[model samples]
Target: MQEVLDALEAPPIDPEARIALQRYYVRCEMLRKVDKRYSEDGRSRITLLVRTIIESEGNENALVEPVLVAVNSVLRPGWTGKGLAFIEAFDGFPFVTTLETMRGLNLFKEENLGQYLGMVLHNRLLSLLGPPEALSAEKPKRKPARPLRRAA
Candidate 1:
């Protein structure tokens, strides 16, 4: 609980609280986005009225929609390398130091703050590059094996 809370310090605001607010917003959008495909207003209203569930029934409180929107807007899909540097400053670190498990934080010094931020951002980049699965391109499906020909 604390870890999640602590990891949400988004700077300029209580990051945890902002996430709560964002979830509420997403719930509302899920009911009525511009597209017909996402129009769940009737069902959403009924579910809210009945069981009072405010989030996706079995989902992990997904941030994919927001993340994808941000990533696509800037990263333009298939854009790789350079890593998540653009987001590191707001990634629960900002003006603080991030402990190994992302479980700790400390105020940044006036002078050394930028250096520490660089280190943290660098580590994040390394982490992104280190995972081959993450870096690998989405593979196309393999064609069916060609039929064996008789040795004539």
Candidate 2:
């Protein structure tokens, strides 16, 4: 779903994010296979997602941590927690500290990780093509991302 949307809307896949996303996709499929194999053998849905996430991503600090923080922090419903490393790795792009930037990003969804990723290939596509008025000072103001209080 998000993949098509993001591809149509996004600029281009960041090199690092692209690699991680690919790994995630592969890992997810593999885990699904394992879970299905076990389930057919009469086992429950095994917790293969995490291991797959780690293996495809290399490590939390190397991959998932930063993306998680960015996703959690920027999305409509913000999120937070310790060892949230993806936030650091995804520092590839600035302004991502704000959720609105992500929504504005035009990315697609990809499979893997703690949750599904926005797989859209849209790069921070600057308005290279747009109405002349887009650059006007009269442009409407955008809503700011509100920060949630960290739980004690």
Candidate 3:
């Protein structure tokens, strides 16, 4: 994936974030190689990467953008399970805060990449925003009772 490589090469705004992104890029490349041979092993490796990204501190765009680009490669059409697993791996971490910066990036320009990622990250976003109750302080209205129907 030239896109992924380009993202990895792009310098991050923060020096520390850049280093972290570089380490992740190297690990991702290694995992991709292992994944080609082992096949089954790719799931766990991707999960590990997802966990590491979410657990990482700071909201630097430099770090978030490339990491997501690299990860998105594995989240293709045939990898629905991995996408779901990726969301599960969030485990209460508010990663969407960091991901917000990526919304305007070009990485999502790829076909359905943005939509696919949106689906994968939907659960995490919901968690961050909380239940519908939290979204609006107003009390929910109760439905009115319907008139009873006559039996034949």
Candidate 4:
């Protein structure tokens, strides 16, 4: 977990690749929500979701809605002013660090502080990308051509 956080905090050599990785994370989360069976199979949910989304002819909006919902659900609690402040300071907070450090002490049988941090990061990335649209509604309409007129 420390390794992952350190890597994330480090400055990126390739900004584009970093952005792509962030998007990939969001996509994986979306896919996991769309299909619960992937979690049961112990396969790579991210890879499966990317492949499925790429190959399917279904509307993009259809695919994005569930992903948005999943991401939204996590952020819903943070909508309040106090929750928002906690979220903003989440990474650097002493309480957060204490919780993470305590995980090594084996207080809980199963600790998921790292997972929660990852989710928060994922939510932040998605928020920056703006809302996902499964289906774009900006198609241009074509006007009928006027009848050809003879030269005067």
Q: Count the clashes in each prediction.
A: 0, 26, 0, 3
Q: Which ten contiguous residues of candidate 2 have the minimum total lDDT?
A: 38-47
Ranking by TM-score: 2, 3, 4, 1
Q: Where is model 3 more than 4 Å wrong at Cα?
A: 1-12, 37-123, 126-152
Residue-level lDDT of model 4, residues 86-152, one tens digit each, is: 2342233233343446466775333344344346545653564333334334566899899999999
Q: What are the per-residue Cα lDDT tens digits for candidate 1 across 25-88?
A: 4665765766654443433322222111112132212222222122222221122333343333
Model 3, 2-89: lDDT tens digits are 2443433432334434454455456657776866543434334444444445533432232344445444443433333444544444
Q: Which candidate gets the maximum TM-score versus the true structure?
A: 2
TM-score, structure 1 vs. true:
0.21
TM-score of 4: 0.23
- Looking at model 2, residue 133 earns an lDDT score of 26
Taking all chains together, each candidate's TM-score versus the true structure is 0.21, 0.26, 0.26, 0.23
Give the lowest summed-lDDT range of ten residues in model 1: 47-56
In candidate 3, position 25 carries an lDDT of 57
Global CA lDDT of candidate 1, please? 0.35
Candidate 2's C-alpha lDDT? 0.33
Tell me the RMSD of model 4 versus the true structure: 16.1
